[model samples]
Target: MNFRLFSQLSSYHADIKRLIKIALPILLAQIAQNSMGLVDTIMAGRVSATDMAAISVGASIWLPLVLFGHGLLLALPPTVSYLNGSGQQHRIAHQIRQGIWIALASCIPLGILIYYSDFALRFMQMEPHMAHIAQDYLHAMLWGLPAYLLLMNFRCLNDGIAKTKPAMVITFLGLMLNIPLNYIFIYGKLGIPAFGAVGCGIATAIVNWSMCLMMIGYSYFNRQERKLQVFSQIIEKPNAATLKKLLQLGLPIAIALCCEVALFAITALLLSPLGANIVASHQIALNTSSLIFMFPMSIGMATTILVGQALGAGAPEKAKKLSYAALLLGLTLTVVTAFITIFYRYQIAAIFVTDEIVIGMAATLLFLAAIYQFSDTVQVVVGGVLRGYKDTKVILYITLFSYWVIGIPLGYVLARTDLLMPSIGAQGFWLAFVVSLTFAAVLLFYRMRKTQSLSDDVLMARLEKLK
Candidate 1:
């Protein structure tokens, strides 16, 4: 018994080390991407409260679009992983080429939407100056949208093959670039006039394109990548059958992300009627928690790659073990983050805003956010595992029901009405957020288990021809 137990313990430790190898780079990359928004909000807040408000509103406009495309491209990595695991390296170049075509087709419509999205302000009735600044932020940020999305495909390609460090290096470079560019454009360091919130948009757009180029350059020159010739088919025509499958897998992911993003956004929007301080406070709490979320999100991403590769190699037991290891790691990290968030909520809140009212309000919100972290960790890890199995449709259905059917409506009632006892203002929305994510966590956990039970047979049948 002792020897057998020791063997299992050793196996767990090895699996964890392997997961960390992939997850650490991904964690840095996720942090690099989320920090751009943090820096943008902080720099904009430094200029003026109105500037900060403009940023909050503008983020609501652009985030869903960016994340929607991102979620869609997520379908590519698992596809590549399956091929790689099955030793079908020859197909990767073709699959990547198809992803590029899909990205181009998707980005054009989104680019037009974001460019014209400035008109959405007419419906919001925000202050004239804030509205104008927000509009400029959206339009100025447009050039980066296509690059941002196209980079996701490249990143996915690298991630599928477990070459994640290049993505980390490139994204960290973007973060380094984002700060100086923000300082120069936002504060008018040279001959340029101070653009305030608009400067963030300009800086983001530039850094985004740079990251995309760097990823492309890395993919082009890497010795191993050259072995696969991932870009050799760059000029190939879009294969309809391939494109359809990519979209079929990706669109549900896209819609699920849209629903999740909308839940957060609408909470911000609904709280807008409360006051500027309320909206600003909510953004700070959301941003901080989101930064903390990157750790688990990266773990989930790594889990998907590992799990998919294992299943593709016809090792269902290995995949299940990988998922278990990932879940344990994610939960452990969240516990630490939750402690810090709850204990030092004030110190964290003060970093984002100067107003005492906003600071106080945000401290309370962060406490609730700490409680929400566990649920967030479970759901994110499970979702990644499900994505590895290509079981995205169930995720969409569960997210829709959890956030929309129950959570959002509950937030509305708790925040605005006395029916759920006394109205709790902005904190009420966050309270609802906790409940929704918990619901998602429980359901996603069940679905992931179900997928595991059925994944082996399904994956074996599908790839039997390849073998």
Candidate 2:
């Protein structure tokens, strides 16, 4: 064996270990967050399908609404990591302060949207009882929106600085709180009247606030935070420039994310008119894919911090190595997941429902999902690195071109028309998804290769101009 090649291989293995070290906690945190959703759905279903529909409807209503705000905050981790790596940790306090302001400002529009959630349901022409429940549930959940947004900033601060374990612990804590509170409120533990699905919303709100308050306590007293003075100006007046910068950086990220989410959502809706079994199959496959996707997403998140820190420390070459290794890890895990999805698709579908037709369709969709896993992994991991690089607007542009301009149209044609090929239903759409994700991966990574080699000075200048 060549000595240099052996040494390089050993170094590569070490990078993978370091990548997993950071990502494992983030993966757990993301899973815990996902579990919160599952808990709500299962608990609500125990009440009635009507109750389940209410909460599901409420979730669908709010999910897109919150994306822009969340996206805005997504920029925080990398930006903070930049300061952290540069030894300018004192500046993070101001970032946190401005993030709070951004959070509060974001809440107002979201609060009003949730308050008028009735209009959304009514517009959909939903069943009256379900609509009322959904509206009320949304209203109840609104109480916690402030808490969720505030917590997100604090949480991102931790993520930015490579202190990821607290986020994992806090989310697990939220999960623990959710189940019991859900039981009590859902079943009327004391004098409180049972609000059914509304009770679930109430419980989630409580958990949201609890998590936020706990994070606050954690941040204030956490020795590192004190050293960095993250909470030093907890009540600083919101700076207009800072707030605008957050929005400018965040909105594109949000839009790009929403584009992908909307693609899936619209595909489901489009698939709905096909048949119940088709829709059910698509959903099962989608849900499973979503769960598996957390792995790469978590890896990407950790990559962002690692890359941002390297860049901030003025080590562009280190940033490049981190990004490359993280992408390799993402691709490797995706390949493993794809094989698992292929081998166990039928069994996975069996876990969801007992209907034979639904099972068959779901298994097939899972196969298609497996096929696209490679492309999906690339897009997500690359997107993460771009976020860390503070080159987020390009993400929005790339997603729009790939998803809307290319993927959606082709999927529509293949699903409904013989313009290019025979109509193939949901499977056809999934094929288009593969193409679009491939396109995004190719284009986005091309951009990365070009930008990744720039010295920290040049990249920092570009990042500063993003404001």
Candidate 3:
């Protein structure tokens, strides 16, 4: 009995190591991408408060739209993973070509929305000068939209095959380029006129296009990728059926992402009237949570790739094992992060602010944030596993209900109204997050089990075919 337990522990450890190998590069790439945003904010703040606000405001708008595109293009990676596992390598180029077309088609409308995002700013009645700066930033970012989408497309292709290191290198290089580019354009270096915050947009656009080209070049030259000949079919006409399938699989994921993003966004708006200190504290805690979130999020992405590959190989049992290992691994990592957040909460908050009250309040919120990591890790990993099985509609349903129907309403009542006892301010929202995310995690786990049970038959059928 002890030996059996030891053997199971060994299996889990090996699977965890494999998942980490794929996840580490992805985590680094995500960090580098986020660092670019941090650079923009810090540099813009140095110029003026209004410039910094404009950059933040502009990012809040564009980032969600970017995530929408990202969600849609996410259909590609699992598809590529499946094809690669099924020994249908020849079909991957066609799949990738279709993905490119979808990206192009989606880019047109998203670009229009971004370019005219100033309308929303106008409606918000923002300060005229800051609004204008924000508008300019969005328009500048518009130029990079296509490159950004395509970069994601090919990056997904590489991720599907577990070739994540190249993306990490390329993205780090982009981050290196952004610092100087921002310096040049923001400060009027090398005889260029200073554009201030707008320069961040310009720099980001250049970096996006640069990274896109790099990934494309890598795909063309890398021996494994070269055989797929993704670039060779760059201009392949879109298939109506293929496009529909991609949309059907992708749009729900996009909407689900929007729902989750909107929850936090709306929460901030609701919390605005509470006072600047409250908002600042909330932002501090939220930012810290988001940074720590990268760890489990990377594991989730790896789960999607690994599980899809297993399923494609007609190994449902293997896919189930991988999913379980990934969940355990994600939970374990979050526990470590949570412990750090809890023990060093005051220190973490202090890094963001020197104000004693804000630091104390943010530290308190960080404790609540740490509590929610377990739920967050579970839901995210299960979401990734569901994507592997091409079952995304359930995720959309669950998040919409959990975040909108349950989390937000509960938070609003607890934070603002006396109906649920005296207002608790930001802590209420953190509690809501814990509740909603835990609700999501439970529902997702059941759904995953259901999927696993159903897939066993699929495995047997495939084996029969082979026989």
Query: Against the true structure, whose lDDT is highest?
Result: 3
Prediction-by-prediction clash tally? 0, 0, 0
- Sort by TM-score, best first: 3, 2, 1
TM-score of each: 0.93, 0.97, 0.97
- Measured by TM-score, how close is model 3 to the native structure? 0.97
Model 1: residues with Cα > 4 Å off, grouped in runs: 44-49, 187-196, 276-281, 353-360, 462-467
- Name the lDDT value of residue 57 in candidate 3: 93
Q: Cα RMSD (Å) between model 2 and the true structure?
A: 1.5
- The alpha-carbon deviation from the true structure for residue 263 of candidate 3, after best TM-score superposition, in angstroms, is 1.4
- Backbone clashes in candidate 1 total 0
Question: If ranked by lDDT, best first, what sequence of candidates would result?
Answer: 3, 1, 2
Model 2 spans > 4 angstroms off: 455-457, 464-467
**Candidate 1 structure quality by residue, lDDT tens digits, 1-467:** 99999998788788888889999999888887778888999899999999998988898889998888898898888888888887888888888888888888888878887778757887887799999999899998987888988899999999999989999999999999999999999999989889999999999999989999999999999998898887765598888888878887799999998778888878887888888888888988998888898889889989889887887787889988889998888888888999999999999999877889889999999999999999999999999998888778888998998899888899989998999689988888899989999999999999888767775667678544332
The local lDDT score (0 to 100) that residue 315 gets in candidate 2 is 77
For each candidate, the alpha-carbon lDDT, in order, equals: 0.88, 0.87, 0.90
Give the per-residue lDDT digits (tens) of candidate 3, residues 314-348: 78888899999999999888889999999999999
Residue pairs whose backbone atoms clash in candidate 3: none
